[model samples]
Target: MRRFMKLSRKTLGLLIIVMMLLLSGGPGWARTLTVSQPNQQIYQEANFASTPLGAVPQGAKVNLIRQEGEWYKVDYQGTIGWLHRQAVPEAAPAKMDLSKMLFGGPVKETGSDEVALAGKGFTPEVEAGFRQKNPGLAYAQVDKVETFGVDQAQLQKFVSEGGLNP
Candidate 1:
């Protein structure tokens, strides 16, 4: 009976140690996200109008620190900044490079301009073709509207005047 009791206690102690080892890694673990959008700017603040701290190209990995509304606070290449949620896919799967795994070497890097152009569905060529088809389209008005922007202070004042939550 004494020997059985000793063995049971030892087994229980080992189990507790194993469980602690497993759970110890949980809090420190960070979720890594790959940048899906090219020229994704890491801003100082969550707002787009804020100064850009740096930019991460597509396929770059960022460690998610936390999320605030539509912004994600991330650490990219040791620099901590905020990236818009649009910069990453909703549920991006980890991409494995078989060639890199087999043979250790750097992967071919894609230019930021190329990646940005690829993501744009409506290219200049496409726009020209559309304009040719529809000559009466008001492109000048569209350009004028695109130039209009509200500054942060003005936006806040407007929100407060309307009694809307900022």
Candidate 2:
């Protein structure tokens, strides 16, 4: 009878330890992301707390370290970069149709700059970077980003018009 009680106590202790481990390990598995935007840049030794410093180009992948609302914390090479959640693409279902999704949502287009901007899904980070680097223009002109809606040929044409390398 005493031996039975001792074995029961050991089992219970083991179970408790396992439960504690499981409870403490909840946050171990975190979501990671890779860059899907074209010509995006990752800082050499900085972090992406809310937004990435420069654009992370298309097909450039990274692991997501953390997330806060629309922003993501990511690690690439030895550098940490913040990327917008919308910019991150899932592993499966590879392609995206930007034109149909962007301007068609709720907001009606009056053919204004805001409408054009809305259709492109352009972020302030991208605009600011281009503005700082590419001066001598009234504004940064994005042509091919709008072609994200169509097939590859249209996209290629758009990129060419905008003089985008990719």
Candidate 3:
């Protein structure tokens, strides 16, 4: 009876340890997600208006800790942070290709195609066409503007900092 009691207690203790380990995600499988947005903001709290921890660029991998509605708790760069579900995907999303999808290859000098897509009246092609129409037009300065770009992030800092002002 004494031997059986000791063995039973030992088995019970081992079982409890195993259960605790499994329950705490030690042996459990972790669901990892990849940030799909060009910039994904990590929030200090689950709320969007909360302080931002930092930003994670597209294709960055994050361990899914837990989910609360539209917000997700993720472990990114050894830091626990909250990210909106829209900013991440189960798998990395394919980046958008404007030249291929919008322009359909080398666009014409008059970039009417970009204007149609961007709703902006100006593109390098449009400027070039303007220069052609009027050779005296000094558009070289304006052409340099198109080279600059900014990343739009779905994060608290982005929201507070005026969110991707083009």
Comparing candidate 1 with candidate 2, which one achieves the higher TM-score? Answer: 1
In TM-score terms, which candidate is top? 3
How would you encode candidate 3's per-residue C-alpha lDDT over 1-166 as one tens digit per residue? 9999999999999898767765775322366787888757999999989999998889888887776656778999898989986685343221223344335895344534332333234655787787788987656666787666655554656667885544
Residues 1-166, model 2: lDDT tens digits: 9999999999999898668756653343354466665655554333443334555667776776655444456777666766655565333221223334335655334455432333244566778887889787665245556544677798899999999987
TM-score of each: 0.41, 0.34, 0.45
Each candidate: RMSD to true structure?
11.0, 16.8, 18.0
The C-alpha local distance difference test score for the whole of candidate 3 amounts to: 0.69
Higher-lDDT candidate of 1 and 3: 1
- Against the true structure, candidate 3 reaches a TM-score of 0.45
Q: Model 1: clashing residue pairs?
A: none
Q: How accurate is candidate 2 locally (lDDT)?
A: 0.57
lDDT of 1 by residue, 1-166 (tens): 9999999999999888768856654443357888888868999999999999987999999997766666788899999989987898553322234345436876564544343233246656789999999999999999999889999899999999999999
Which has the greatest lDDT? 1
